[model samples]
Target chain A: MTDADLSRFSINQETVKQWSLPELVEGCGKAGVARVGLWRAPVQEYGVERAARLVREAGLTVTSLCRGGFLTASEPGARAAALDDNRAAIDEAAALATPTLVLVSGGLPAGDRDLRGARERVADALAELAPYARERGVRLAIEPLHPMFASDRCVVSTLGQALDLAERFPVEEVGVVVDTYHVWWDDTAAARIARAGAAGPGGGRIAAFQLADWVTPLPAGVLLGRGQLGDGSVDLRRFRELVDAAGYDGPVEVEIFNEGLWARDGAEVLAEVVERYAAHAL
Target chain B: MTDADLSRFSINQETVKQWSLPELVEGCGKAGVARVGLWRAPVQEYGVERAARLVREAGLTVTSLCRGGFLTASEPGARAAALDDNRAAIDEAAALATPTLVLVSGGLPAGDRDLRGARERVADALAELAPYARERGVRLAIEPLHPMFASDRCVVSTLGQALDLAERFPVEEVGVVVDTYHVWWDDTAAARIARAGAAGPGGGRIAAFQLADWVTPLPAGVLLGRGQLGDGSVDLRRFRELVDAAGYDGPVEVEIFNEGLWARDGAEVLAEVVERYAAHAL
Candidate 1:
């Protein structure tokens, strides 16, 4: 227990998706875990202000808000609505006092095959939003989902591409999430993570670091195939080391999206997450 | 039908996995298809000499052999066994008078996570086998599987990585396979194809061009999720143009692994493949 400092450990609510905001906050507080990463739906459902006060009262930190960007909509009306939604998300993050708002760049627009066009639109949307994020003291964290999701989820499929987009804005206003499950397969990830931290304007640039393993025979549809730590092929500890080497001293959020994990009790899942994080991600 | 010449079209038998060697050759001959790509097991089962004679008698061109490399085995005994297998595949290609042998670099060694190590060994194996392939008048084509297969199936995940490895050997001895199903999501694929053909010591060095579309709700295992032509997101026509622009005028082989397509009658599947190839791949 001498080196078991869980200060930087956090649980993303999606890992225990069935848990309510209040229960999650109370659970983390009781477990001596200091931080929780929240999703937009539950917070809005529970009332963002109440959720914020609940966590504030429980002395639990809000590591990050689930998402804010789907800015690749091609239709003018839909695109405008996405931006408006992102604005609201940023405001919610501000209300929750979370320093980072995760952004999953929208996939290709329906009936649209232009991936490059979609990625470019994400950059343009960021330019519009970075000032807002900066004004609120929140960094927009662009999450680079795996290439498997390139067509349907997030077009920012590599850490190098995420940094390419993140660099266009100030480091303080925008940054990248080095989620183990997403960027693990990337050959250049270690170097890119290093560059993300060192090459940014003032250094210390990684906004959020997440942990999720990758297991094969990916479940049908593949979205819920994220493996629990130590259950798959990814060298999770190495990723932790890489981010640490890049001088990123921040919350390492556990973010699994597997059906099996989601089927379990929240406290039980949180206990195993902490154990695996210490063993596989430390 | 004036412009519907299929002189450069070939169907890998796995596209009709239910068909036998003699039946496949006869089916291609019946369909007015001149070229056919082949797999190792069925060829061996039918006897290489017999299969070669059968295709030759049927006036069918053997474009390429299915595969010859799984050189990432770390155990000395297993590694030696894989090489022996690949060497035999090359000898079979030579006997069949096939112009190319496709290579699928194996996945990570069992219980091992060093992907870079496995990839480097693929290079080592290629260096050993390239001269043997060249001496047999057969070129080895490195097929880069999609990034999704980076862990459990194939470590060579992108066209760029394939070209990087193939360029280390002579152009005639080694070349790259441009498979749309495997590489459609890659952002730099078009550029990589151009480099593959134009930058080799010998110009126009692409050894094989494979076509398969991508579909969603990928089945349980995800391996058999390849869509039928004109059935998914990939712009197969644009890929054909990219390969054409790269100066590849060789056989455009249709190699799909799908449950639904495999369940249909082989002749019916072949007919539909021809129609779809003309529409989506021309």
Candidate 2:
């Protein structure tokens, strides 16, 4: 990639949920972006196989697939369905030639206050699916969501806890995502990131590194307020240095979920993301 | 204190911010709540000295003072003002016969992103105030707010961080507050609380224990969404047991900030709070 192209930068489509698959591929291609992050629903809507081919034809790489692991359902049928969906996700990741399949460990089961138990369910699901993912040459990347989402979105709330669950399997099969937004508040984050990426029995390793800022007065639901890089309190350059020090030289995906960004022109958002990634995270 | 009085129960004034000092003292005393938590703003408005006298005459114990320590202000003058305010808080707590003065470490100063630096400023302020609090027979208790408030309310966002800062001073001089609403999502919380209260150099000792439940769909600005005892996902009984196991047989203050409850009759809110605390926490 050219110095200005930032070959390591990947724009997560959710940053501009306004863009369609073909539109995203075209936009990234014209902007000289080498990579784009994909989400399951939209990729499946465009037909995973066709979508994969479209990006491939455009010479754009899929840095990582959006999600897979909401496997905390208590009902036997629901749990099986979650696993089946995860398996399909693995297949899609393989098709897209993306190495990492991000897992947002689902929230506690309905009416369930057992956060520990729900977290264990994530481990169980990972154990059952690791081999499948390993065989497909894909790694299941456990994304420890911010604690705000601990109750209703993801039970995994810390990098260390995510590492504990991811380390139950071979490092090549399972790993952790080090998103600056979710983890900047964690005091132990820098050290834990080092340990996770270190070579040892407990090495879960950094599977993906996404960038987003932490802003205040989070909107209702607190889901769509992820700040664009350099817009909030996160020290993006420091995090970049940490991941790089941990030996992760993969794509640094920009995966924001902000209402303001989504409302802007998709090309404008992509351009701004590119510029910010270069100025703040690269 | 009667056998079934749950004598350790204290209600933070903010739970019913509507109640005047006289109203709260009368209400809490009649409801068999032997102790009550007070905020500086309302106390000052009601005349701090007079408010203290009212609670004392009502035979109510002041468990802890609401807050002090917004030491993250960037301007040098503002920082001095925060320290001065904290010193005044210590005097107020002493006057009210409260042993603990909770400190909500302020968020980042405007246009500032140096979180580590801001956190260090809290440590510095505590060092400056701990001795003053000790002389007044009041312990400076650092309250670790939830990570969601890291940018706007408190830079100290984890129980461990508070303990680390508090442990720097004499155990009796400095301590940490174990507020369930703020720390419930921390995986290391139970262990940290134990460490804080344990008898050793690292033993920061629990200065206060407050309760609130974790609820979702946080309101706009996310300030007043604190759940009442049984209305949210927190297993209050479990936290009550954790603190008890840590040998903290002190006031278990019920603090919540829900708009729904705040809009209701103060008496009805206190009644439900008592009922919920008895059933869900005590």
Candidate 3:
């Protein structure tokens, strides 16, 4: 494959959530994928040092860490704990040599109606974590989830809102992650991607481009029904074209959260993901 | 009951979806609700003249028509047919004496990825029909649905987006319908309501205020499943206060679409609805 193809692909670990860290690395490497996005739980389970070694041994790049946010809750202690955990996550991402760490700003604090205040707290947490992330040469990528998740998942529910947060933080350390599954339905996506892309490298703009498809009859809890490439309604090629037009030439990471995909053999899923990505997203 | 109290409540026909039009009218009268919203199918089934006479006989007011939008489609012929039907719906709303005709901007055209264009088509249709509605003394109220319906239902999914459309037409002829179930989760709801309120009576803002509770574990094909007041997580009183703060003292129409509620006896549902409105909404 050409170097251009290598620069345009990455695999978010969620696409094969059932696999162990080493198995995921081996599978992705064999599939000709250059980069893998790691989720914190898996990294922690395998131990960060071992996970880092496995990734290195497999010659696979760690594109970005899956998460480091949920810094909002009624209890001050829980919020503080999230921040502490996020700091460790930043350290782990740095160790893995991942340049970006994604953050899904948590939902409304239980028993509270202060959405605006929760958003402020997210900004504050990002501000506090920015310096450490920058010192480690890692960038924070804020992901704006779909509005359906506004209540219990992420309060930052629009591309514009995520961009606002990115703009408020230090550009050297903070950026935005554009996931098609979440923001594809947004009317302002094209314009927002263009604006983010114009911000340039390390300028706190589009740090990662994650892919998944939109499907109907969202499952219970409304969080785990994400479709694999070509399995649902979203046109990933058009989305890729839009991001490319906006000057974002980053790796297109596949991040499905479907139970069916999760239950399959890791290698089989990885192979299908690579084939689907090339067919529907490239 | 005092005149002010009577004036503060409206019943959306869907609250008693299991009831026939005459039964709904009788129940509204028995409950002493001043106004009622009607769905097109019920109006068509009962015949417009009979429905109007029932409302007049019951001493109940027709607050707004339940719906008259879904103009977007794959074929031009289908769109034209929808527009023709909308015209007939406007005539029926006029015959029923409802002052406002609600619109649910339809979803993406089949095989079409242009959401922005679908939205523009909705605006264009509204513009085309505004004069007809104005002539019939029926104001058009664009109801912004929740984003979950962005794919198969309405494209106008936020108050801001609805207001943007409202701005495209003459304010006196077109306005926004603020449904709590749809817009309650929006982050900018308060600000949008404030903006709507600031645009005075003739400015076509806050033409209707709908109430319903949001419930989780939303059942599949969730076209129905609204929660009863105080039954879910939505803080109805807060929303009522917000709209009131925005200078909207209009009827708080209860528009529940729950299958569970629909199965109960019509009068029983109406009685519960009235109690919930008083205890939870006000």
CAPRI-wise, candidate 2 is medium
Output the worst ten-in-a-row residue range by lDDT, candidate 3 chain B: B1-10
TM-score for each predicted model, relative to the true structure: 0.96, 0.97, 0.92
- Deviation (Å) of A117 in candidate 3: 1.7
User: Worst lDDT window (10 residues) for model 1 chain B?
Assistant: B196-205
Count: clashes, candidate 3: 0
Q: What is the C-alpha lDDT of each candidate?
A: 0.88, 0.88, 0.83
Q: What's the residue-level lDDT of A191 in candidate 1?
A: 90
List model 3 lDDT by residue over B130-150, tens digit each: 999999999899999988888
TM-score of 1: 0.96
Residue runs of model 1 more than 4 Å from their true location after superposition = A1-3, A201-205, B1-3, B201-205
Tens digits of per-residue lDDT, candidate 1, B21-60, equal 8889878878888999999999999899999999999988
Fnat of all models, as shown: 0.60, 0.64, 0.26
* Clash pairs (backbone) in predicted model 1: none
- Which stretches in model 3 have alpha-carbon errors above 4 Å? A1-4, A200-203, A231-235, A263-268, B1-6, B231-235, B245-247
RMSD of 2: 2.1
Tens-digit lDDT track for model 1 on A28-133? 8767788989999999999999999999988888999999888899889998999899999999999999999999998887656677888999999999999988
Residue-pair clashes per prediction, in order, are 0, 1, 0
Instruction: Give lDDT: candidate 1, residue A227.
Output: 92
